[model samples]
Target chain A: MIDVLTTAWNWIAEPLQYGFLRQAIWVSAFVGLVCAVLSCYVTLKGWSLMGDAVSHAVVPGVVISYALGIPFAVGAFAFGFGATVAIGYIKSKTRLKEDAVIGVVFTGFFAFGLVLVTKIPSNIDLFHILFGNVLGISRQDIIQTLIAGTLTLAVILLRRKDLLLFCFDPNHAKAIGLNTQMMYYTLLSVLALTIVTALQTAGIIMVVAMLVTPGATAYLLTDRFDRMLMISVAASVSACVLGTYFSYHFDVSTGGSIVVLLTVFFVLAMVFAPKYGLFAQRFRQRVYKKQLDEMSSPP
Target chain B: MTMTASSLDITVDDISVTYSNAKLALYNASCMVMPGTITALVGPNGSGKSTLFKSIMGFLQPSQGKIRVGGFPVQKVQKRQLMAYVPQSDEVDWNFPVSVFEVVMMGRYGYMNIFRTPRQKDRRIVMESLERVGLVDFRNHQIGELSGGQKKRAFLARALAQEGKVILLDEPFTGVDVKTEKRIIDLLLQLKQEGHTILVSTHDLASVSTFCDRTILLNQTILASGTTQEVFTEDNLTMAFGGLPISSLRQMTGQMTGQSSHIVNRQTSQNAEVEA
Candidate 1:
């Protein structure tokens, strides 16, 4: 047992000595934190599909940025915001529902990105943009992630109460003189920024998982937003650390492993959480039933 | 503490609301809510009652005309926190993860400066509001755990915490029990006595005659609006609820006659009745 433990320790610690691995871990952890925090609002507002839409829609922006030889964040944010506007415009212009509009717009952008990638002779790796290369991230990528993550966290914290009120009841928020329209766009901008920060760690395809899973798991565990935020952060950070360690030891894809670990956390929370978990709720119902039966029976 | 009451008069002038798809929800509707009175807006479902209220609250823009609150435009009065709105309980997400206390405290958001936390005074007002709605003991409870009636009271408490001179409530009596309904009526009466103007949109004609000083019957436009005794007649109700079964209309008119007579007897000393 000691030998196995020592071998595991060496496996994790040996990767910690490398600068790339250290950067990868830090970036992934920060991405996890920001994604988790924003996920609370995303889930509460039923904007999960919007997160997916924005993340996928960033693909064309990234391809176009590379084509123009500019930084990817600028292009990514523009396209993400553009996609949201397009969805809104289309929904308003036509009778199509919001979900249908989102599906059409994102798939179109994603296809356009694929065509652009194939037509361009640039060295931009479509694989890396889609699946991420966490272990291969450079110092610049790390700094970008750090800055975006910090800004997102600050804005969310500063406007937590207002944001919560807006999501819970937008009409009431507006009636009370809150700039609900501005807040709506601000939330979308933050989501775009958070997705941009996460791009390097989870890539486009899996970033939605990182954005949604941790908050959903925490939601199953708690009934309060503050506690839900704490639980989401803890869940995501731990998953990042553990997944990074295991991916280093096992030589697997870091992003894939991290998402797998997040899924595991979600499943556990769904089954075992005290109040809202499946088993716990059934257990309480059974106990109540037994008490009722006893009360109805002759003594 | 003594409640500082200020009467606010609302004048909705020739307001017309059209949806993005060009559906005319409200067509050149107009009404006047006098200060220090409770006016009930009664209509069938989709009769533009909610649309009118939304336009008044500045949530929905009117394609034509304007709304004025206390001599200021609706938009300006909203910024000054002179109006409070209690939306129907169904409009809110009950599963939202917030405490009853926090929801009530949201009413003070307009009064707060950006980046500032709630102070002692805000907290005291929230607590007082909760006490008024009889939800003081449920301050720490999650909002979703409350019964439907409790949820309505919780929103009422939020409106009370706003301390606005004008309150607009949309369907507060729906899905609530008798006790909660009574409590709400008592609170509205108290607020009216304290010199606040209130407009409630409801489908309950019985409660309209019972509690409201005036009634507005609407069907995409104002069918009739005046003192309860003057406007709640069978013909006006028939105009508002078109195509109603004759038997039910007869029963409804019978009930309206009984209530209108009671209102006439009660308002004999006052000359507040008006025809529309």
Candidate 2:
């Protein structure tokens, strides 16, 4: 036990201390919190697909920005925001279901990003786009991700009522004089930024899990938004810290490890959650039905 | 209120809404909604009744005309506190996790600050609204646990929580038990006594005879609109719902008091000023 404790203390160990792993772990912590928190609202709104859409869609923007030698964040932000608005616009203009449009646009844009990446030098590793690597973590990225994530979370947390109203009944919200359009677009923009920051640590491919899986799993276990958010954040942080440690020992990719951990948590929650979960709900139903039958039949 | 009939409330002037696909839902549709009165805006399934109601709230911007509350355009209406809207069930998800009291308190969100906590006044109002809807006992129950009628009553509680002068209820009676339906009607009358300007869109023409002060019948356009006893007639039924005229209809569909087949003028606007 003492040996294990000393080994853990060697997070200050020489070889582990010099490189990017520490920075990567810190950055992943923030990214996980941001994505996981925002995704509570997204999942509640049944717009969980938007996370994958925005994350995958940012690939083309990132590739294009790389080609232009510009900051990838700008391009990703622009395209992600554009796609979010386009989804809303298409729904308003035509009668197409919002999900259908999201599916179509997401696939098309993501494929374009893949093709754009191909057009660039083959030597540059684009695998980071599919599976994020924590090796390149820097001080700047950590600061940027932290500030943006904290601010986004604050804004969303503060406007909990308005945001919840918009998600549940947009028509009622509109009738009440809440600017649905402004709130709608503002949510999209924040989602876009959160996705971009998360992309740095989790990469485009694994980011969806970070965004949705924690929140979705939390939702299965809880009803109140506040509790769900807290659980999601807790789940995300646990995955980040544990996955980072596991990756260090097993010699695997950090983001992939975290996601695998999250998936395991999700599977457990799916079966064992106290209420609304598959197994528990079925068990409760049978018990309730039996009780009702007993009372009505009078033995 | 049992006060007066003709207090100016909602006025739609030359309102027109055309979808981006060039489907025109309403055109130059103009009417007035009087205070303390239940106006049944009736229409066929494909008609523009919903479009007109949505346009009135400024949810759907008019293609050409204007919608006003108390002679003031919708843009000039006060913030989210001014009006309450209850949408049909299809548009709402019953799976959401919220208690009955919490849902009703949602009506006060506009007045509540984002970071600020709910004050005692807000809680009292929410309790009172639930009492008005007769759901005080179920205040702590999760919304998902409520029956269909209880759900409608909960939505009413939310609307009452708004304490708005104007309320727009879309198909409130749909998918409810008959007993629940009458309970809703009684609740509406009570709200009417509270001086609420109520606009309800429904398929029930019988309400044209019983509660609604005026009925706006629309099949894309206003076919005929007037008081219950005035507008419920053979000729208008023939022209409006031609397949089932009032003469051929059973007692359930509607009834005609006498041989006067033409639509009654209702003189509704005239009675608007003095209900009692």
Local error of candidate 2 at residue B24 (angstroms): 3.1
Write model 2 residue lDDT over A1-299, tens digit each, in one string. 99988977874453356457666667777788888888788888877788888888888888877788766777888989888877778888777887899998888888888888888853336787678766675565566567668778888877777887788888777766777888888788888889878867788889888888998989898877778889999999889877887788788898889999999999999999998778998999999999999999966
For TM-score, the strongest prediction is 1
What's the i-RMS for candidate 2 in angstroms? 2.6
lDDT, each prediction: 0.86, 0.77
Clashing pairs in 1: none
Worst 10 residues of 2 chain A by lDDT: A10-19
TM-scores of the candidates are: 0.95, 0.89
Worst lDDT run of 10 residues, candidate 1 chain B, spans: B266-275
Return model 2's CA RMSD, one decimal. 4.2
Question: Model 1 in CAPRI terms: which quality?
Answer: medium
Error of 1 at B247 (Å): 4.7
Q: How far off is residue B13 in model 1, in Å?
A: 1.1
